[model samples]
Target: MRKRILGALFSYSVIGLITLGLIEGILQLVQLQSIRSIEIARKLYQLSSREEYLGRYCHSYIWKSNFIQAYGQHREDFLSSSGLHVPHKTRGWTTKPNVTVEVGEKQYTTNNRGHRSQKDYQEDERKYSVLIVGDSYTFGSDADDSYAWTNLLQQKDERLQVINLAVGGYGIDQMYVTLKEEIDSYNPDLVMVAYISDDVFRLKYDFRDYKKPTLQVKGGNLEIENTPIGGIEETHQEIKAELQKEDIAILKLDDLLFNLKISCRYPPYSLFSKVMGQMQLLAWEESAQFLAVYLASGAEVEEKSHESRGEEVFQRWAEENEIETLNTRPYFLQGSGYQGGHYQQAEATIVSDTVYDKIMDLESWKKFVETNR
Candidate 1:
């Protein structure tokens, strides 16, 4: 009886190994076939043979090497030595407070609150303050502090106190977090959420340039992920762990089965819409008027266009939510307003003028300005 039991166990073990081997073989075969198909498609359709298009699976070592090459420095050095940007427990990274850094002809100066301003925020009861939150365009990247649209807007009117809380490289998720965390302190009369279409697509990644908070839609509500975001070393370890778990054959199979696109997956619009809704709700809770400003990118300005799928979705979402929106594309298209993939001084002027006009057109803004003045 003992001998018979041992024989049965041995047979089962052998069968299990054989099944696994067969599965691996099938996966490899499928991968090979997929690569051949990609090659044929590239030749026939004139598609570029990019690594993403070819579905070249990067192993753990290769991925790490690629990351190092992309950054051009050790992770620690990159994170610690990144000028003006210090790691934040919640927002990922924010500008160092009361610090100024000069790069070429551009000067980046942060006030006491870490915003891109020269003056510390002092709430004035007599003035109607407009709080601006968004990414680099709103933060005025590649432009001087005085040339930023936020500053220009402030200069346009003395009754308006424009407070810019924008940070470079922030996604809508981070912007929402910033607004939630900072709005009550300012308690401004109006809150303007400005963004470009690319900012929406940034929702698809947990890390861009560095670690960041990501959001998801759960049961019609937005849920924050990666809370108390890890430090540089921790983030690096997490990324390494993720890469180590990669199953090349399985990854290849997934790429082939899904015919995955070259870029990161399209931005999750449901999540995006939910986040915007939450922002609107937050503003309502604080009794502050909320406005969405869609800034144009260099490409959009060059094309003289305003409509992208992301922008269209956002417009529809705003309409459904009864949220007011201002699109700056038309204003940007009126002249050569872009440079180096960001808004030049001319574009900043255009944005300020357009936004000022939009604010003047709003009844709530008019009433707020009147009451405060």
Candidate 2:
């Protein structure tokens, strides 16, 4: 009886191993095919063969090879070569101060304060200062310095001094941190926090292109983690070592077959809500009127039902919190359209018009103008 039991156990173990091996082999073959397809696409479209560009193609794949090839390589080249963004101790990365870079026909210039502007910010008591914080959309990714909506909005009203503190690839968490750190110094009468649906998902990544600070919910409050983020190479080494500790064969198989979308343990919206609350508190403490601006991407603009879950939750939360919100989707739809997933010149003009109108219509702005007059 004992011999039979041991034999059966050995046979079952062998069967399980064989099954796993077969799955692993299949996954390897599928990944190879996927890579071939990606290469064809790259060649056909003249897509960049840069590691970062290829990494975007690998994002949907779960093979270990895909992850290994792309990990920490996605934005490293751009960050190093562009000289626009540099490592930050607290925020993980920030825009390099007073640098100018031209891409295609568009020129990006950063002021000494590290904000995207042609000129440095000088405190003008006569003007109502507006501080804007957000990701690439608010940063005006593809738009030239003169054509960005912030600059356009400023051109509309002489009484307004608009200062954009937005950085590309920033999550709402980073925006909050920036607002807290810079608000008192700028002493803006109005603060605008602009975000797209994708920015909320970015909250889940502690490491995207390079290391970044992540946020967590603790006892109904927000806690920041992964602070003083390491350099690209350091972060790469840590991730590699950690992955190496796991059973590579099983990990690859599980990732490929099971499709475990285990990016973050916490739901993104929970942290998002906490960050938004904290931002509101900070703005109030600084005596600034806070506004949340929602900008829709081309996908959301085209498909009405495809509005992001993050945006829905945010709208509800804002209403409940009595936080004023602006949806810029209508303005975008009314304009020419988005270009390369960003606002084109005409759409930017629409944004500027909408925001200027919103500000003028604000009771706070009215009171401020009245008081100043």
Residues 1-373, model 1: lDDT tens digits: 9999999999999999898667545545544435557655444222222344434422223334454445445444434443878778888877788888886888878888888887887788778788889988888888888888888898898888888999888889999989889988887778899998878877765666567788887776677887787766676677666655652434334443333443436676777888888888888788888999998785777685435765777778877877789988777677763564777688889899999988888766789767765
Candidate 2 matches the true fold with a TM-score of 0.80
Worst 10 residues of 2 by lDDT: 44-53
- Per-residue error for 230 in candidate 2, Å, reads 3.0
Candidate 2 per-residue lDDT, tens place, 55-115, comes to 4432212233333566555733435656788877777678888899998888989988988
- Against the unseen true structure, what C-alpha lDDT does each candidate score? 0.74, 0.73
The lowest-lDDT stretch of 10 consecutive residues in candidate 1 is 41-50
- Most TM-score-accurate candidate: 1
lDDT of 1: 0.74
Q: Counting only residues 3 or more apart in sequence or on different chains, how many pairs clash (N, Cα, C under 3 Å) in candidate 2?
A: 0
